[model samples]
Target: MSLPPKTALITVGATAPFPALISASLAPAFLSTLSSLGYTHLLIQHGLTPTNFGGTPSGQSLLSSLTNLSTTSPLKITAFDFTPNLSSEIATSDLIISHAGSGSILEALRHVKRLVVVPNEDLMDNHQKELAGELEAQGYLIEGRVDNLPEAIKKAERATFKHFPRSGSEVFGRIVEEELGFEAEG
Candidate 1:
């Protein structure tokens, strides 16, 4: 008997202030390609994007588009505005495609999930690209673009994710004491 295919989660945060360009780019053609590459299910958290087309897509409209896309592709697709159980979603997914928000990056890294980051370059003074680039350089994630999402996904299958160091309050407190001469009472 053959095992089931892996699942992928793509999240574009509502607080991101811009649509997820990569997801938008993937809709018409690449979804089928992803399916052929062995992904069984794809869950897209569209956040507050107004439409799923080329611009800001409303959640309903995006879902409609995704539904249509799913009909044409073998991959089972689900698109939602947002999910309250984001941590649960993250934990369940085998691969993650996300906007380059710090929280998303950290969570995926913490879970050691295979990650692909598509930073929203539309935002004013967006630093997400830089962060994603740095992490990609360290082999922790793949930095992707709207125009080349399939290539990114193909590359991510073989990409290595390095273990990220965890920092805690005690470590931060020590740094503060040394750098700013501030001490916390134990």
Candidate 2:
């Protein structure tokens, strides 16, 4: 049986059926490479609009910016938007490729999915790059920064899939239980 296409979460770019429009954060070369690599599902988080799509961020992609990226890649791609149900699309993701926004990165890792983090420098998303770099150091994500996407994808493909600890949730429950002083089941 054929396996599902490897997913790469992209949390940047503008999709309006405008091919000439270079992706704001979509990185054409990166997208092209993934396509060549035979990955089918490119999981994308809608990003904020550039003040200028070609060269700037204009508006919030979604009301919360976190819910969606200013990009329309998800809408126009015809790949992920297969159904009207957004939750199903996100829930079935196997891989994730996206910007280094803190929340965005956290969500990908929380699910323990392999990640390809692409940070945008043009918009001064330096913090995102720093976060990606740190995660790479910890072996949490594959790096696809402006300069080194090709090799990063290769490495991600071969990365040792280790489960990131869900440390907080487990710890939090313990604290709550202790505070509430629940009795043990007899």
**Whole-model lDDT, model 1:** 0.73
lDDT of 2 by residue, 73-149 (tens): 33223222123443344456666666655555666667777677776665442555665666677677786754566
TM-score per candidate, in order? Answer: 0.80, 0.57
Worst 10 residues of 1 by lDDT: 168-177
Q: Which candidate leads in TM-score? A: 1
> Model-by-model lDDT, in order?
0.73, 0.52
Instruction: Give the alpha carbon lDDT tens digit for every residue of 47-115 in model 1.
Output: 776654555233445556666666677778777778788878889998898898877877787777889
Model 2: worst 10 consecutive residues (lDDT sum): 13-22
lDDT for 90 in candidate 2 is: 40
Error of 1 at 155 (Å): 0.8
TM-score, prediction 1: 0.80
